[model samples]
Target: MTMIFGIPIQAFLGQLLVGLINGSFYAMLSLGLAIIFGLLRIINFAHGAQYMLGAFIGYLLLADLGIGYWPALVLVPLIVGLFGMAVERFALSRLYGVDQLYGLLFTFGLALVIEGVFRYYYGVSGQPYAPPPLLSGGTNLGFMFLPNYRGWVVVASLVVCFGTWALIERTRLGSYLRAATENPRLVQAFGVNVPLLLTLTYGLGSGLAGLAGILAAPVYQVSPLMGSDIIIVVFAVVVVGGMGSILGAIVTGYVLGLAEGLTKVFYPEASNIVVFVIMALVLLVRPAGLFGRDG
Candidate 1:
């Protein structure tokens, strides 16, 4: 058996694949964070809760209504987006003119409330969600066996990331979004509905989290506890990537995941700390992050 750096190639490749899968989740979650922070300028501490809500919603749809993965992928995001809008209207929106710390505090409290409510009803035990029949098998490539759903996740995440990047970077609506992020008052003078745009942007961010949750449902146990488990590492990923750039978030997620995978193969004990270590190094070298623009 061939080896890379004294580790068996098959083992290395398996870890690499696992890393990519984890990276997909990181990328999706961080993308949502980047969008919310960029446009709304609020640190959405409730993001993880919203992600959990997405998975739970998807699971309920599947169990109760017999809805499948494909439709839930589309509808769950919408449901979560609406939930985000309600949050903005009832809770977050009220804080728009206050100190930034107020927004952070509000969202943190909201996270606790959301998590506590779910815990009260469901307990912390996890539930399994089956992958759609179409994505249940694996293909044996000459190099390795690749599970179809895992492959689909990688491709879908890439497509969504790049598509979002293009939408924000190239389109006219995206142009307006960029302008609003830069100077909302100036954009408003040009006849754009900046507040509405802000609401929509937050909704979009929350919707992405929802989509990620739905995607993750089949892979991870659908539990109220899922978001709390991953959100910290994701925050570290956002810090490393630079919180403001969409493309940077995606790149950082994949790179960090690969790094973690390599660590798992060579030094199992260091794998968990690797991301935080990189985050520290990035903070020391570039406090604004790998792609952030200093304000």
Candidate 2:
């Protein structure tokens, strides 16, 4: 068996695949965070809860409503995204002119409330969610076997990430969003509904989180604690990538995920701390983050 860096090639490949899978999640989650923060300037602490809601909603649809994964993929995000728009309109919108901490605290409290409500009903146990029938099997690649669902996740995430990037960087609507972020008053003067834009942006960000949650439902158990467990690592990814930087968030997420996976192969003990260590190093070198602009 061929070996790379003293590790078996198969093992290395396996870990690399796992890293890419994980990186997909990180990229999706952090991408949402970047979008929300970029335009709204609000640190959305409730994002994880929104993700949990997505998975739970998907599970409920499958179990009770008889909706399959394919449909839920479309419905769940829409539902959650609309819900998020409502949240911004009723709650978050009230804090726009207030201190930034107010927005943060509101989201943090919202997270706790959401988690508490789910825990009260679900009892903290992981609910099982099976992948769709069409994606249930594995594919053999001679060297490493790839799960069809996992592969779909990686591809879907990449599509979503790049698609979002293109939408923001290349599209006319994206131009308005960027303009509003820079000067909401000026954009409003041009008859572009700035408040509506903010609401939609938050909704879009939350919807992305929901989409990620639905994708993760089959891979990880649909549990209320799932979001909390992953959100910290994602936050570290955001910090390293530079908060509010769309491209930075995407790149950092994948890079850190691969780094973490490699760490697990080389030094199992430090696997957990590797991301944090890297975050600390990034902070020391560039406090604004790898892609963050020094303000």
Candidate 3:
């Protein structure tokens, strides 16, 4: 058995794989939060609810309509994104220009309501979602056995995250989005639909959350409480990465996840709190966040 720093290589790589899996979820989720806050200036506490909603919707689709993972993977986000747009239009849109507290409170309340309904129906035990047949097995690496679905999750997340980054940083539409956030009135004067843009941006954020949810269904239990369990860590990821900093959100998620995994290897007791510890340290040194422009 090959050893790495006193641990078997297989054991080390196994933990690292776990870290990457967790990091994948973290990156997608924090990216969503960062996008919404960055562009909309609203802290959407309903995000976790949206994530739960996605999982539930996917579950329902499979249980009732015979929709499979592939379809759910596409449809779930679209549906959730549309729901997010509706919320932005009818509820969140009205809160703009008011105290930020109002938006926060409203989203928090929305989360509770959604979770309550789901719990009432699903009873919080959790539902099992099987991975697609194509991704049902594992591949043996030199050191460890790698699950196909897990590998897919990592690849899909990186593709989506970087693809999103490219869209915002490299495209003309992205330019308009950034500009609108900077000066909506000016952008509107230039014939841009700022409100619509904001609505779509929020939808995109929510959709990312949903996508994460669905991808996670096979890896973890699909439950109303699932989102709540992960959202807090995702928020911590956002904070440490610098709130609203897209690049920061993506990077910090993976970094903290790896740190957490390694901590579990070195100090199992500290694994759970590692992300929070990093958040506290980052806050003390730089409240603006690692990538945030604000101070």
| Candidate number with greatest lDDT | 2
Per residue, candidate 1 scores C-alpha lDDT tens digits across 11-59 of 8898999999999989999999988887778888888989999999999
Candidate 1 displacement at residue 103 in angstroms = 1.1
lDDT of 2 by residue, 58-77 (tens): 99999999999999999999
RMSD to the hidden true structure, all candidates: 1.2, 0.9, 0.9
Off by over 4 Å in 1: none
Off by over 4 Å in 3: none
Q: Compose the digit string of candidate 3's lDDT tens values, residues 173-285.
A: 98999999899999999899999999999999999999999999999989989988888999999999987899999999889989988998889999999999999999998
* TM-score computed on alpha carbons, candidate 3: 0.98
Error of 1 at 230 (Å): 0.8
Clashing pairs in 2: none
In candidate 2, position 25 carries an lDDT of 92
**Alpha-carbon shift of residue 87 in model 2 (angstroms):** 0.6
Reference-based lDDT, residue 243, model 2: 89
| Each model's lDDT | 0.90, 0.94, 0.92
Candidate 2 TM-score, C-alpha based: 0.98
Error at 112, model 3, angstroms: 0.6
